[model samples]
Target: MKNEDQAAMLLLGVGGGGCRLAASVRAVYGAGLHAVGVDTDALANRNAAAGGMTCLLLGGSRLSGHGTGGDAIQGRLAAQDDMQNLQAQMNGVRTAVVMACLGGGTGGGSTPEIVKALGEMGIATVCFVTMPFGFEGQARRKEAERVLPMIEESADSLVVVPLDDLLKDAGEDLMLENAVNIAEGIIAAGITLLWRLLSKPGFISLDAEKLHTMVMRGGNALFGCGSAAGDDRAIKSVAALRGCSLLRSGEALKRANALMLGILAGSDLRLAEVGEVMCEVNKSCKPGCHVEMGTVFDPAYEGRIELVALAFESWTAAVMAVPKSETEVAAEPPVADVIPARVGGRKVRSKGGSKLSFGATGRGKFKGVEPTLYNNQDLDVPTFIRRGIRLER
Candidate 1:
């Protein structure tokens, strides 16, 4: 990937859990990655800053940098207060990968506002949010669920990772701390794979432009990754990926309308291995699924193969087409050649216009009353009718 492309993308972490996740991804991807973390807790911000990521404290004056204490409303207000500071960090960024863990105050509350801000700035955002584990109790789960729709509304592509599903394969005896670490590691690895696919030199490159276009069309996505080594590493990696709980044991692929697959391996990777991986993945996916494949070679990945897949279930090609303005829509020919019209107490047929009453142009009894106006436009009449625009059938 070129430096310009890398500079255009940003990895943003919101709140404590989100900051930690961003730190993990940065640690794996190293120097070139541009990352920033925003949180209500001053201490947490300092810790994340220690990891070499730029950190900003939200609601420093109002909350005194203490934190929201799981109050999502406070978190939301904090983000709003410090929104300009966050926007300053987004100078040249065109695509933002936002990581947040829902259920907690900052993550649940601040994420929606931040994502919305990024969208308003014309930055494409792919949000990766983790839902609380079942063991975390009903309250936390409910909190996460409540904030989900808000994030979904603003994010271009949303990848939801339910912690319960993520840790299902871990042994029941696993410690809570270890389980959390493992989940973060797995998610970080998948994100790293995606970053490498776009930033590293590869046999077949998946550039930032392509990623932006795909994400614009990919409403919600499923992300998962797996690794394997030894003679049959490529095949084994695919099998492991198929079994990934995040992907619902390959069910996501079957239902996906589009997929972005990245293969990372060492210099010894064989041409046949690449073919084998693709072939197996293709078998798992439904017919007519759009697949974008890329391969990355690095010395660090010697003797192993890492496979990452992002499945977009709601992918639609219609979004790729440019939307028409009201003027353009109104200019289209009417569905019917002629329509009935009233003229001087006689019925007449009018050509090139539909008989459909798009909407009432004037207020019936309230016409003589004072009209409500906004920005110099009368709010009493329907906007289309006021603008003198006709609707096509």
Candidate 2:
């Protein structure tokens, strides 16, 4: 597959918080893409480089000390710095995607700033970020609560993933690495959808403006399978998805491509039943077309069965690659390669270890919140959080 549009990927991370995220993006999508690291802490730059992000900078003000007084001020200043830098990067790219850990030091703080800058420059921005797990603590939660709204308000479209909920299946025995894998899987799933629409041959290849429009309209449409208590079986239904409305909304699930199916089962469901459900789902789709099947289950539920499906158009589908070897390379250094080796920038610092004083600022606001995080309070509780940019409220 070959991509005709010039796309630039900006990988932002602060400290080791963004390490796995940056690494995950590289692991799934390889070289010829630019990667830049940003952090006020030197460690973040070092780790991002190790993770394969080429550019690392220390533009965000470093967080020091403790307590939650006016610490938000420093965050606002950091956000401002991030916005300035991001504006410079949006120079020639038609599409820009940023992958970062939302509840940490650098990435968390500067992400909103960058988004605001891009928004002002008319560049489309999509963010893939994780919230802190409930068990982390209040500090993280407060931090997340404070910054998330600010960040969400600035971006064209924001996709906030709740890792704790997504990986609950990993169970109590899960390790940190396992948690990371789960996060990456969620990230991969989100990006893969976009990649399919833009990179494939049959789907629509969206530009920055169109991308931004969809994002502002709540870009992602989610589907999941779940079973209820008392049902001792798995249910699979074959339904043809007929339409092209989804693709127009940046969802990319049309009728011409293979159908997207989902499965859900309860504790009582037998292995045979599960097998039968999957087989039926596979057979329900159009022949000779590719099908992407997703599944989920809960052992505690007594009797439950769930199946979901979506479709995509063939003409608008894309299967293109970065075309690193063929596309004419840019003369200037790619944004990914510009992150500093160490975390030290000309950004302002706070007086006390806990906060900084950014002379003056403005108000900030987000039109509509996405379903992934903003609308669900149960999911909104910040498991982790770090501060960044500030603007007019």
Candidate 3:
């Protein structure tokens, strides 16, 4: 079938982690949500089936569902061998929202390949991934970081939430399982807000077309959702989101070039409160960001307000070739081509080994140009570096 004839938003779960996250999203979204969970683990796929996802067990010849045993390369190969099978399932998908927890073998390996396949078929994709927790060991962390750019390469935009940061506010008394569940809820909520903003109109409408424009313009991105009840709900929700470890609150929120802010509240929502929240969030962004805002009023949120913020760096245009609308082309700012800096004309730059302030440059390469040496193993670097793609200002 031709690309234009096939159309639907596919929520694809890549591996065990991805599939698990996908399942959670499917539960909240309920019926009418097109969701598929693909994995190399037969057991995991079975579990996903129990949760109402169409589970696709990939690469029968390679692994036979025993699992990847933490080998991402084998996971990648399995997905590659089963590309036709994966493509068969994507016949009508115009856009795909990929969910996965990175760092493990299956998710780390198969996600990029799946994303590449979608993009090649002219289907735009937005990826939401979770990095490993600090306690998950440096090996997993390294793997997650290594595959990041590869994921970014294939998807139109990427939203990465560090697991460790997501768990920062949870006290030591919180059980491990509960913490993990809460993290899942946060991710599910964030994407749910975006989906609602696009699919369901509110008092201040943010339609699907405008959303795709923002998502396509976004490169690497950050996502977070926070809610508060009772007094000062609006300000408190935005403040909570700003202080969220998952948001890297200060860093990611401040550096985003394009941002979509969604406010969900009850009919009792105050106009002044909305203004205060937007003002506070705008204060966090670099000056003159392209901010798309909307509000959804629900009786369910009588005394509560929730905030979902998705922010992107300028690099989102790196791989995306979509043509900007006439208005977009005409409204280009003076510093659009240059790497974005924080307000006050301050260029955030890291030298030697410190973390830089600029979002486009990324966390930092290392002490020098050397590949990161973790536990005596040399990590695989992105092609941009090997090809000497100019990354910094």
**Would you estimate the TM-scores of all the predictions?**
0.81, 0.51, 0.77
List candidate 2 stretches off by more than 4 Å: 1-4, 8-16, 60-75, 201-216, 219-393
- Runs in model 3 lying further than 4 Å from the true structure: 1-7, 297-300, 315-393
- TM-score winner, 2 or 3: 3
**Per-residue lDDT of model 3, residues 311-359, tens digit only:** 7765332222334454544332233232233221111122223433323
lDDT of the structure predicted as candidate 3: 0.73
Provide the overall lDDT of each model, using Cα atoms, as 2-decimal numbers. 0.80, 0.44, 0.73
State in Å the error of residue 24, model 2.
1.1
User: In candidate 1, residue 49 scores what lDDT?
Assistant: 98
lDDT by residue for model 2 over 141-172, one digit each (tens)? 67766777666565434555555655664568
Across 150-249, the per-residue lDDT of candidate 1 in tens digits comes to 8887777789999888887776898999999999998898888777765663776456556556655467788888789997888899898899888999
Candidate number that wins on lDDT, 1 or 3? 1
Worst 10 residues of 3 by lDDT: 342-351
- lDDT rank order: 1, 3, 2
